[model samples]
Target: MDGQPTADVVDQVKDIPIYRTSVERGHFPILEKPEIADGFPDNWMTPRLAAALAAGEAEFVLSTGTNHARMQIIRPPYFLLNSYYKLWSEHPDISATWEAGCQRVSLTTVLATEHVARVNAKKRGGEPEAVPPLDDRRLDARTLYLNLRLDPALWERDDVVRMLAEIRTAQQAHPRGWYHLDCSGYHLAHLVQKARAWGLWEDFPQPASIIHAYEYTPLNVRRHLREHFTCPVVDLFGSTELGYLYYSDRHGHYRPYLDEMSVELVPVAPGSRIHSLIVSSVRNPYMPLIRYRSGDCARTLDGSPDPEKISRFCGREKELLATPHGPVAQADLDDRIADASPRVFLHQLHVTAGEAVLHHTTFDGEPLDPRACAVLERELRGLTGLRSRIEHREHIPVGKSGKYAWLVQDR
Candidate 1:
């Protein structure tokens, strides 16, 4: 790692077994999950790390594996949570709300909700309850988890009523009747649509600030959120292993939050606008990953490798699709679909041997007009160089991870 500007990191890890070879060779290759797991804690054990563990200042935890395989990692207690709070308190658009003692209500995945319930149950020496108490779902003094179903589309009236009642309770707890909303953009959208349909929208408390940080949010979904909410709709791009790296402002432009970290963008292929995200972060003291491939991809404002110029955290590099024109990213296709019609909501591209089919559902439960469908087909054909068609459905299902997959290939 010679010539790397992060000299402090080099000094810190130069003696660690996993990084010794790279340090000696003056070249650090991208660190993969398997390599980190092969040796485990023994490879990373140093006097400082051992002492931290002994003092209960650090502990081992597993990544959520939302986008990839789960992996064990070490960090201080509540490391990721503190990082999020710091950003929220400092963000220009939402700082006032954060300082005003606004409580947070998270609505994302059933996996997350279940994880919390199970942990609380274990602490209480009891079996996991199907409907845990509200205090059990509270992560801390301020944050609460609210979703209990894998698919928001399957949320019955009772489910919606319970969640809205919780939101009302949270709102009442605040002196100003304001609370912050943290959610998966898709999940929040489904909740809004269902609340309106069931005449329960009046019961739902309006949020002072909204953040969708769970996964990749489609363009049309974001637009839908803006149409329904008057507050800021921000997107945070990061992972469980790495704390937040970038966040969008109220205007939807990304700004870097690399405090003790640096990033390098390597093209997925020659002559491609999409680049793989290789991160070197010392944010987690127990494990400082060097040149870690985060499995994510992005594009720059002017197609440069400069990290500050990053415009979009498109999608996972593994999800990029090959095309005659070049590689196409999720954002690449989303831009076209949004242009064809803003009504298009959740969409997945199913590519087979000779043709590509777009399966989609709309916010209003209706298919696109004939002209809009034709325009979408033409745009997709030009982008992928394949026969393309649109198939509208009333509903689309989420994956086991409680997130949607934008691409599915049968070839």
Candidate 2:
């Protein structure tokens, strides 16, 4: 488990105790969550890093652990956020938002619970503060603002009334102010959907630009944002351990923005188009992950595992559903649903030993017709070779992280 990256890229850490006594430079063995957790701080800790941690100079970043094993990584302060800012400032689509003097506002999935807490506190006319401390630093003269977080549980009747009131309050502070919507959480899409339902769409300000990172955004959510807002919707691919490595253009095509990192796409299985992302990053001063399997899965253009031709990041590697035909990924389900109809907003596939049930909702606020539902059920059976049932619901459940899962194994 104590394997050092063999890649020459980690030459800087060659003398470090953790790296010096471990595996060769080019042969980076997969670093599993269990292995990381088993050792915790001792395995990767060095004298300098240990001192920094004791002095509060380094911080622990918790993994969302939505679909993967939960783990924590220690790094310097603002390491991940600063890295994202750099990537954002460099991207052509996002740079325009910065130039327009719009600040970045994050309302993504992870902020949901905290967002709800703050909103409820404010409802009682109390001052609410942010947890994890907002990085209020300026990037290119534009401030990066972290507003209240959003949790899906609050999307219910009683709380949503308060949620809307809170959202309107935030919106009024910057009406038509051209702010960048940094939707790192689940709020924006749900906010838009619910606001429209409650006849309060006009109260929310139009974003100057939209940046989606930190979570897997459903196609329906993307469609809703694009149709309602005229701003550019950019998707970024990265994690807390690594900075923003790739970004989607206005056309939704991902292009590399690796600052000081390199990547290799290795197939999860032989002849499989889905490849696990193995990244080598010495970008973080306190931590360097070399040839590290990121636990995220992706596919390449033309169905080959070429790093340069990677087309789409499918989903988490551990979530790949085993089928008689082969492994079916989240992207496979997404493709099938979109082919059936673009109206399908959110979906969750619960795979049990006997059957798989698809709980889904459409954008029109109505259940899918019998024909469309049958088509989707058949598609699931064809791909997964499992008895499939389609539950056309008015609403699908969201995880506490405020993210939706395309596939879930019944435990």
Candidate 3:
């Protein structure tokens, strides 16, 4: 089909009330989350969708809200999981692992683990246990969830021991004693640091393949994982509403996996390099989103609004910091920090009174050298056109959603 909305896309959404005005006008506006949630399932429900729900083909779910407020969405049962498996089984770099029947062990936010446990508990008609059993945390026969804490940096000795044990169990269950690791990059880095410190690294099983799909991983965190694991450490970029869109190969180059979906990039501002991601996807049969603004932003290879040229999934549109130079994305600041010091782990930029202050923590819990701090300050000034200072911190807390906010204004 052509890049524009196809006849099938028009037919799929024409009956929905949210699209009726656009359908009649022959022009679809950028659909935002608020519009999508105003009437929700009722506005989206057509006879076909209604039948799908009744027949158990469609199910209701909430977005993970890592970047913004959680929104309700409908899709085919196990839609996201199926999308992940499709990528894993077909990815050129990791397909061999999938074919070998390597089980997946997920280590991410406690919220995710709790969500799975609660779902399993509901299926069994009981309250969610305080600490879910191994069986309860298993997403399927091939996948298991592990971390039960919000902030990985705050993980105690007991937490690290439990998660490492789970990983070992998952690895041993496979005939080849190999498992695919799925995690947020930060979480895995913290685990490695803690495991080594506690003298438990030897007991931890090395994964056959690693995918950090949960959030926008920092450059330093990626390097830390690479230093530890010999396996492919890939990053999968997409949202809860939309399954895996683009994935990084072993060499850290992103490749699109847009099947039955299309993307359009609109520049965030007049002269900004960052572009907002708008998606037209029919992948979810129950709810086809047309020209939906995904609240995510990216940068292209040549600063053009070409989706195929998207080089980096930079940051959330809502979190972008406006500057005299232009709009600064999380990845923009992260690139400078990573260049100045490889030790920089988690960082947040706070803009106040026309000055920018960067609070950061190092991987080894040591402060940056005076020279490195000077370099970072100069770089920040150049990027933001404001006086800048670097403050080394012992820790930076994660957000309520178990994610880090890179941009903080007046705080």
Candidate 4:
């Protein structure tokens, strides 16, 4: 089946309003953004779902959509928050690392000024975080989220000082002085680097557990944290559309947490090890996605396109680079850089017709050698069939949400 859902699966979501056409057609094609977003509530609404929303049984969540258009989706109230807590509180290996009732703090991408204020309001009984608070069946605790949004240049700004102070306060205010750091890995790395620069490393709290769910954590960031901190650094792999489906273990190996979803991987090109992730999820009761091209890519352990052997959720599919030879993914470029030097902390590939420029920085804050640069350029040219140039930088810029893009095209 190669991960594609059989026609019988259509019966699963047979009643969903949006799937009526596909159900009639008898062949469910891959769902795309336009169909998912346009006409939204009406396109997806069913009488039962409408009653759920109107009666406060369901709610809406917004997606950050770092690389594409933002989206709004209907979901069970507190769906993501509850799902996250369930994953943590249920895992024996991960749960023991923290106190039974330790508070959870989210300093990741979802934390922003307005969102923090709203959450605080809910805690104060001034507003409600979720309807009926899920009858208090959901986890109840004050979540200390960041009020400031992350940006590429946040570390260099004066406002970040207050953010650092806020984080310190959150840590110290805890009775045990150890709480979970629910953060984006990139954002956490930025915080640590900035803390070191400001001489605040001594005051920085050591988290009992770390959860990085917002985005992909590069190998360099993971290695740095594992080397310095003696805590479990967990990486949750999933999307806003689908709650986390996989998580990394202590050894950095991903294990499936698939609840109501099936996944398949199709090769990026003929004989290529890399494959695009296609997901069929009926996890969300309000909306279901079938044969959805997640725009995420991965590779198998033994160079075969097998779902069970999937190794890493490597990179995005839309960002693939077209060269004279063939298409190359962000992971391919990242692998080349990693093979070239251990000191390379971050990199971005900017490409134009027949040429490419690499903006990269080293961990030691030193410039990459011209000889080493030439060697990598030669390698990239050989692999991509384009002239490549390396530009050593003190830091490569990140997106507004503090996520780095490995590839940026000029043309």
TM-score of each predicted structure versus truth: 0.97, 0.84, 0.97, 0.87
143-210: candidate 3 lDDT, tens digit per residue: 89998778888999998888888888988988888899999999999999999999999988999999
Model 3 Cα RMSD, Å? 1.5
Instruction: Report the Cα lDDT for candidate 4.
Output: 0.73
Residue 79 alpha-carbon offset, candidate 2, angstroms: 1.4
lDDT of 2 by residue, 1-411 (tens): 233344566566665455554555444565556766666777777777788888978877776676676678888876767877777777887786555555555565545335444545555686555553332212223433333334553465444455444444444446455567777434576767777777777666677778888777666667677888887898999987887888888777889877778787877877788888888778876677766788888888888756677778888888888877677778888888888877887788988998999988776778888889889989988987889998877766667555677777874
Best by TM-score: 3
Per-candidate clashes come to: 0, 14, 0, 0
Error of 2 at 60 (Å): 2.7
RMSD of each: 1.5, 4.9, 1.5, 4.5
Q: For candidate 3, what is the lDDT?
A: 0.90
Kindly report which residue stretches of model 2 are placed more than 4 angstroms away from their true locations once superposed. 1-8, 23-26, 54-56, 110-176, 184-186
Backbone clash pairs for candidate 1 read none
Which ranking of candidates, highest TM-score first? 3, 1, 4, 2
* 3 or 4, greater by TM-score: 3
**Model 1 segments beyond 4 Å from truth?**
1-5
The TM-score of predicted model 2 comes to 0.84
CA lDDT of each prediction against the hidden true structure: 0.90, 0.70, 0.90, 0.73
Ten consecutive residues with minimal summed lDDT in candidate 4?
130-139
Model 1, C-alpha of 302: deviation from truth (Å): 0.5
